[model samples]
Target: MDMKQAATFIIALLCAMCASAQTETPDTISSRQLDEVVVNVEKPQVRAEDGVMIVDLPGIVKDKPVDNILEALGYLPGVMNNNGMIWLTGASNVTIILNGELANMPLQNLYQLLYTTPVDRLKNVEVMYSAPAKYHVNGAVINVVLKTPTPLDGLQGQVRAGYNQAHYGSYGGVLAATYAIKDWSFDLNYGLTSNKSWSREETWSNHLYDGKRTIIEDDMRRIGHNWSNTIFASASWKTLKLTYNGQIVSDSKSWNLSSGTLGNYTNAYNMLSPVGYHNIALRYAAPFGMTVGGDYTCYSENRSQSLFKDTDYLLGSENRQDINRWHVYVDQEHQFGKWQLNYGAEYQHSKDHSSQHYGIVGMADNPDFDDILNEDVASFYVGTQRSFDWGLTFNASAKGEYYHNKYQHNWNFIPQLGATYYKTPKSIFQLNFDAQRIYPSYWELHGGTSHINDYSTIIGNPKLQPYIQYDAQFNYILRQKYVATLYFQYGDKAMVQLPYQSPDALNLIYQTINMNYERVAGLNLNAPFGVGYIWNATATANIMNRRAKANHFHDISFDNSKWIFYGSLTNSFKFSQNCPVSVSIDFSYISPSLQGIADLSAIWKIDAGVKWLFGKKRCCELDLKEDDIFNKWSPTMTISHAGQDYRMKVHDMTRNFKLTFIWRFNGFKPKESNSIDTSRFGTGK
Candidate 1:
């Protein structure tokens, strides 16, 4: 269906559901719950406080066909899991934390940890549009709170195994155990995954070089296999806690084949990455209200790439990086009646040893460098939160940061403010403002080059600078079930990767550069409704306008703007209490959007899953899921502005089917972990 029709249909469906809900009487509602015993206790599924939206995760996942924390996050309103990346609607980026602490690991490793964590361990999830300084994160944040083990809980454990089929086959398993006695708790989790993945990309580029327009076409197919292992262990005694998180991922057999005007080329890639993180934290409650924490992380990766043309080796490159980072923080909080005050100071240092070597057989330029980089960041912040008797709650914080590096040194001041008005139980209003600074990836600041073909190369820019982002949001919650949000975001000196053709040479360079600025204003709506006790539905829509401008982009200056729309509808149905079976169907659509200088086409997908509970006390669960049933998730990107013409289509293996089985022994609890700044630890590919 077209965009207009699809939107209309979604609105009609939601209206029809709302109308049906209105027709139900008290007696009908009571009859709907007759199958399940009611305990006469009512708990709000969603609430807003301290500029954060709290969601009762257990209630939402009770009937969903999700076995892990990562999958369960997809069910949260306004949150989307697009190809394993979790994103908040209308936000540029999102940070995910466990138990209010960020995990100090790579995004992939953090995803692995969440994927292996059982959903039963989640207590609630906090969604913050503008996180405070104490959180040590920027923009949108999703805090995944874990349930602490209680006395007499004893030993609890769970095991899960999953198999997936797409263009290839993949399997994984997880084992987690937790023990608690009195005030001491211990937790350990280990997971292993072996995955084979495949994807294909078709590119058509029209290059204007030497006053002649040349059209280049490339069809590349990528296939890879990787093994990932993750382990997390923690011990907590009273208010003191110690934890370790480690992961190792090896991709030994990854290759790509391209056949087109390039005349057939083969690229072989191999990588081995291992990360180790250690953290210790102690907190004293009551009058002191002090918290002190420190963490150290060691990360290393080795990667090699080889390119050949018709069995003739053309180029070979080797890249390596070893990084050591340490962080320390101290926070103090004091409570005075309905008002609370907090202050914190944190310092972080990272040392990176990196080297790149290139061997070229032809006349191409060789870009190689070996360098050691050191960075230090220190920040101090003070904040206050207060709740008035008039149902008004507010929080504000300002942070000052001092950053130092070999290239540059600077200081930044960030401010955050949020207020919520909930004078009535049926209606709530919230407003938040936040500002943060974003730095370039470490590798991006290193002038290194990697070749895709003889004509196309990816290069880094050493002069890249950090940027600042500002966000403001206003929210309205009706009856605690419907949410409407209006938000505006601006990125100063935004960084974007763009393809530039050399006017003097037959070369196409892909580089990440600082754009002039980017601005986004959007409105988002989320409505959750129930059709009695058997069916539950959530509908969300986001409409936004994006504008980006750049003055000097490799001899071209342009201003681009576009309006984007994204919507999703998710429904869950339970067969019956006796059968213990549930089914879920979800649909999402994204209208034409603009990214950098490229225009993206519209895309949509439908996903469905089935879950069954068996064994005594429903200790065993079997879940089957199919995603992208129509195989229409990837969007075509076209660039036709500023004397540039390019069209690219990706036919990836996004459509997949998977089956998972979960077995719980006794009960399972989770431990808290700290987050690391591994986002810049890679080769910046």
Candidate 2:
């Protein structure tokens, strides 16, 4: 039988088993305490605190089909996890933190860590629309808080193994352990994965060369395999912590077959990347309500990529980056009756030594270079929070920064404001405004060239500049179960990757450039409800309008705008409390969207999953999930403006079946670690 048929059969069998095991009935209880018994209700699963939204993760995942922390995060009101990338509704990008601090690792490593971690260790999640200056992050933020280890908690550990079937079969495993005694705690975690993936793309370009229309069609198929090893270790004594996070990825190989009107060719792309991160931090609480802390981070990564075409060597590239960064801060707090005051100052410095080399068939087209970049930043901020008898609370802060880098120097002043009104138990309202600046990737700012095929190439521009972003959001909570949000965002001097066909040659070049501005205004609605004790559901929808403008793009300039809509609905069903079986089905849809000068088509997907808990103490868990059941997640792209005409379609292996088994011992939990600046670690894509 085929894979889809097998998945259907397995789901049917599990349903039958659950049905057969629901023979026991719940026992009735009788209470005779003055005719009527008073029972207090539990705390709400979601609430507003300060300038953030707090979600009770444990309460939301209880008796649900959630298997890990990553899965649980998808249930948040405006959060979506699309193929391991987390995005907030109507927001550009998001930053994820652990225990109110950023993790010093790559995005892929962080996702893997969350996938292997047990849900029992999560205390709560804080969603911030506009992060405060203290967090040192722009845009939206998702803070994952873990439970603290108590004294005498001897040893805790967990082991997990998983297999996935897509166009190919892949497997992996994880092991984690933690120990706490007296005033000391230690944590160690290791994971290994052997992954295989596949994708296909077809491009049709109508080139207008020398006033002649030429139709170029190229079809490419990509297949890849890789092995990754991740390790994390930490030891903490009171307020001092030493942490190490490392990842080694080897055997990274990919083969791309391109065949069409152009010619028949095979491209072999091979890469090996290994990264290491180390951090040491110390925090002390001194007299007169003062706290001081400092952190030192050392990070390094080496990546090499080689491309070959049909047994003929084409190009080879090596990229390396070594970074040493440090930060020191001092904070003071004061209490003035019903009001609280907080002030802090921080300074940070980073030294980066980055180098790149290219070995190309045509040596004159590519060059090798090395450079060192030094950056220093200093900031100071003060904030005040107060709650009045009128059921209103507000916080405001302003920060001034002096930033100096090798290429440029600037001074910026930013202000943040937030307020919440929670007079009634059933209604809550909040408003926030924040601003920040974003920098370009390290590799994107380098002048380099890489060839994809004979007629396609990627070029980097060293003149890329940083951009500023402003955000405003208003949120309303109704009955503590429904949420409505209205938001606006504006980006100045935005940067985006655009494709350009050389007017004089037969080459198509892709490059990143700066845009004049971009604007987005949207409204989002979320509702979560339950029907009896068998079914629970959450639905979310977002409708927005996007506008982007550029004054100088190659030989043409244009303004583009579009309206988009996105929606999702997730349903969970429990057979019976005694059966220990649950099922879930999810659906999502995205309307036509706009990116730069391209217009995208609509896309939709359906997914399903089943979970079973068995063995003594319910320590064993088996989960089966099938994503993109109909295999319609990929969207088509078209660009036809300013003499640029192109069309492309992608047929990737988005549909896959995954099975995971987990075994826990002695209540396994892991500690949180420090963070570093890894946003500019690797080469550009």
Candidate 3:
């Protein structure tokens, strides 16, 4: 047994003999007695139509102990999580889609498969900022909806394990499976994680080359080990579908640097990554009421990095990157009463290859470098949505695109708008607008360079350019649990990562530029309630203002303006109705922001969790968690404009303690999806 474990045990024994021959056929026992003739519906936990906004992840992880989906997206509401990158309040561009297509993978393997998936297999999470044109997305979108088990006639699954202690100590495991037999269904997932981390960093710099002014200081220590693996598989028969998601990562690091302007340094690094994506789909439901689909997607990535220089033995080089991607789509939708029509077409292709190999220990002319890139895109879209009888509703769209790269080629046309109004039945109002385009990634167009010793380095830019964004929003809802938003966004060429100052006098290059404008204006508030009878709550708030300009940097030109605030709160406690136990608490706060040339400071966090349940249909469970609890979650960066001056501080591993266990057997429940799958177009960034 080792032909890949005998081909995964002969494909799980031929899918359990095709689910035991469809339950010994008899029309699957009258279709399992007509699927138990049941009807139960419940939905609501934020909702808004047309311009989208829907969150109902089982009513927000009811009694939370949420495992995965990035800890349930930090409890929703405008979703923001920095340091783990995920932002949405006032959006600066974000995209992630799974059920409604587009999760093409990469972007650190989609955040390691959404932090190892399982949030009860998810179901509902959608937020779109003017993304229409039949979901041929643009600008902002989240959309994650899964859990579509629809009777596999039994055979459920779950098994998990976890343990963690920060400052070093870690463990992990997970295995999942689902099988169904009438109209066919099968799903499988595997996970593995390992970790060891510790970090500390400090830096200060001020340099002005050949005419004096040079001040530098540094202190650093980092020790690391991170291992990851995640895989997902899907198979569907009726309406045809196939899917796979993958992730693999291995990282190792050792660091020790003490510098007062380049003196002592010690570094060791290793990295390996493998990313994947695959999908095939087809759907139809047209006897005239239209609903058609088509999909194909494939993505790949191979990465490698190795660097070493323990003080001065020097010999740090070897970097590689490879990527391949392709995507195709076709879509159609129809509904002719209150009016709804959507259309789409898409195509995408990508290729990138990179290499760097430099050495001194056996140096044969020591320098080697290579980069290759290719990109192509084509898209078309049309959309319409309408409804009226006084309480208005309307949506519109038009999108067209053609882009190719090898330097440049373009064609674009995009337009979108939305409106909704309902003055009674709990009031509502909304409006949205959009025009967006963002491209440039593939290591920012693969013009590469990397090194962080002998004075820092990391540069890439293949004439990087492609940016255009304009967004607007106004939303209000009350009585459905209050929510309000007013937003604005603007961009033109914006793409940043600038920190130049290298003309000998001690280097500091950090490039990736294109910014002459950037903006954000916002307000968002969300409140969800429940008080008498042991808490149960949710709250969010964000207020913002930001501006940026990089005036064609020659050595970093700058202009940045800022005002920002953030807030969050989540609570749940139900002391006891004869004890099954529960508790949860979450808090967040952030203030101080001004990106471009840094200047970021305020940060805060607190998290807590506890849950326990007895066996017998409670399926077995246990959880205890703690994160950043009073650690004050540090994060600091400061950079003082042109002639350059900078500062940095970080202390990692964000406080931790975790213990988890879960087991489930018979009743697995995870199906439920009726249409909508575009197979994630061209994945991550």
Candidate 4:
């Protein structure tokens, strides 16, 4: 083995020895035996083959999912991927699925639907960055496993309704439903809300190189309306499984913008976005017991963005955008003695189209940029999961994908291996090594002028390269409960986002680029206590370094890169009364961000809610969520190329309150089925 492999193996060996005391069983956790959380989750974690934190969705939500969609995947730390869009990392892509089928709709629109759908509808939202044998090439995968039972021999259904309002007199309504027969299942859900929110901003900056300084202040008001809808179904006959998922979402927002240096009046900005999506999957289990599954997705997305500057040129025109993704996959798995073998092939095609009407300037030149995206891809994956007599399970998997996009066509094979060892009845030790390959997204390949707003123009790079990452993780579990994990990752051709100077624009622009290699290593630990008068609580801590494996930009004098620390403390509290109340506090600290180019900042966010129940099956709730409750100093500030000079933009918001209600008519207990509420199972995660 090479040096890297040899070093990893040595480290793994040392960890296995030091943490040997952790190898144990569930009973070890309590005087009475209790099962541990199992994170089967797409064969990703190498820590322990048998158990890991299962991002337990159902356990987190006391009520059925009819309350809110975010509740479906609320247990996962990485569920909220928002860096302006659905980005897994600060600058990576993300794709979501429901019932193993893709949600061919615009992601923004998808979030809208979830806003309408009750969380109780989802069985679970499985989040995994790695592509499993049964998955396609769509970055990370978010499988929204709908609620269901394990017995697999009956029909079940549930419908939930909820209402919520805010201090601003704004309110929302949500409806969620699911029906599953012996061989078929169907689901329908929606969420509608009208909200009033406002923002005030003050900026002070000096374009040192341009010999200019500007002081600006602006306050904006927005009455945002969001409507979301979802439909899904799945059928299984013996071993064959067929599935369908569809979503229709729309959001319209009105904003008032003003600037002291550039403008004096509050300018109104309005945008209406409509998105529709549909997908179908067909899977067949061969007579030999091996299974094959394929799926297709279609999306109809349109965005109309407008700015009201009150002037013809300043009167921002309405702009439109369209995006679509098509994917088909086939995979198989078989049992071989102590090993389970899996393999698969996948094909994908994606296209993005932008329609520009009239905006600031330059966007009128190209209505649709073909270079934005046009590609065909083929991929193959294989793996094996085996268990040892010591109760240790080893899982190894690999993937090779080929992409033929306009910018580049390349092939890469990524490999991963993991081992879980149980040393004693109360302990567990695990280790894993993974090499992942990532290709640039449509925008990364071609980001050009956007007709939407002054949100800087986008530019694409034809010379961009693929990202190859080496990931390692080590974990120690105690009493099948408390857990600690240390992770390290290095990447060559790592995708990084940097502001690119726009010579002809009125705003700053940041583009995704592979100008530098990055290496990051961090640690994560979680402690989940038993339920009590006080809700469960989890504590997490992490530190990561983004090293400059290589750099080329000279204007930016830098070497060695920068490091950042992330930490979070979460809690859940409940009232024993018929009504339940919950509260959460989130804080994120960034040490000057990567490159040490900016000042360090701390962000404190808070969310509080109360669920009032008249009985066991009926309830209503009021939720108050706000970012920067203290209206403290701005949380995030970045300077990028805007028009001819670099402009600084800071985002800070005040408190937002939302009240919600939930009600369920007779919880659907399978008619001939046991009324045993299995929902209460898996209490500890």
Report the lDDT tens digits of candidate 3 across residue range 1-685: 6699997984565455445434442346555677668454434577677667777865666578766676677577777766566777766666777777544554555665676667777888877777776666776677888776757447777787889898888898887877778888888878888878787878888777888877888777777676777787778777566666766555543444444556666665555444445444545444554445544445544433334444346555656656566666677778788898878787877666666666545555334567777778888888889978888877888888999978999898889887878857376787888887777666646555666676776766779888888888887877655778899998887888756777665788887788887888889998877664367888888888888877777544677888898888888775433345567888988888878767889889888887765466467778887887877788788887666777888777687889888887776534444122222222111
Residues 1-685 of candidate 4 have per-residue lDDT tens digits of 8999997995565344334323422244442443455333222121233322234455555532225554444445433322223433321334566555433444454555555555555554554444344544333445566565433523333334333333244555555555555655554554454445444444443333344443333333334454555664555665667666666555645454554445544334344545556667677768864555555656553444444444634434443334555666666779889888888777767665544344544645544443345678788888878887867877667888787876678887777666678867367776756565666644444444432234333444556687776766676777655666676666777765544443233343455566466666666665655365445665555566666533543145234545676555556554331223344555543445553223334544444443333434333333444433555434554443232223334544444444444455436321211000001000000
What is candidate 1's lDDT per residue for 1-685, written digit by digit as tens?
Answer: 9999997995565455445444444457666777377655446667988778888767876777888898889878778899888887756677888887745676777788889888888888998888888877766788998878766778898999999998999999999888889889998889999989999999988988878899989999999898888888888888777877888776556888899986999988888444333333433333488777777778787888899998999888888888888888888888999889999998989898888888763544785789999999999999999998888899899999999999999999999988889988689898988888888888877778888888788888889999998888898988877889898989999989877777778788899888899999999999988766578889999999999898988789878899999999988886433445677899999999988888899999999987776665667889989999888999898988877988989898889999999888884533331443437777744
CA RMSD of all predictions: 6.1, 3.6, 23.9, 12.8
Better of 1 and 3 by lDDT: 1
In order of TM-score, best first, we have 1, 2, 4, 3
How far out, in Å, is residue 341 in model 2?
A: 2.2
Candidate 3, number of clashes: 12
lDDT against true structure, model 1: 0.82
List candidate 1 stretches off by more than 4 Å: 1-42, 272-287, 361-364, 668-678
Evaluate model 1: give its TM-score.
0.92
Better of 1 and 2 by lDDT: 1
Best candidate (score: lDDT): 1
What range of 10 consecutive residues in model 3 has the weakest lDDT sum? 676-685
Q: lDDT per prediction?
A: 0.82, 0.77, 0.70, 0.50
lDDT of 2: 0.77
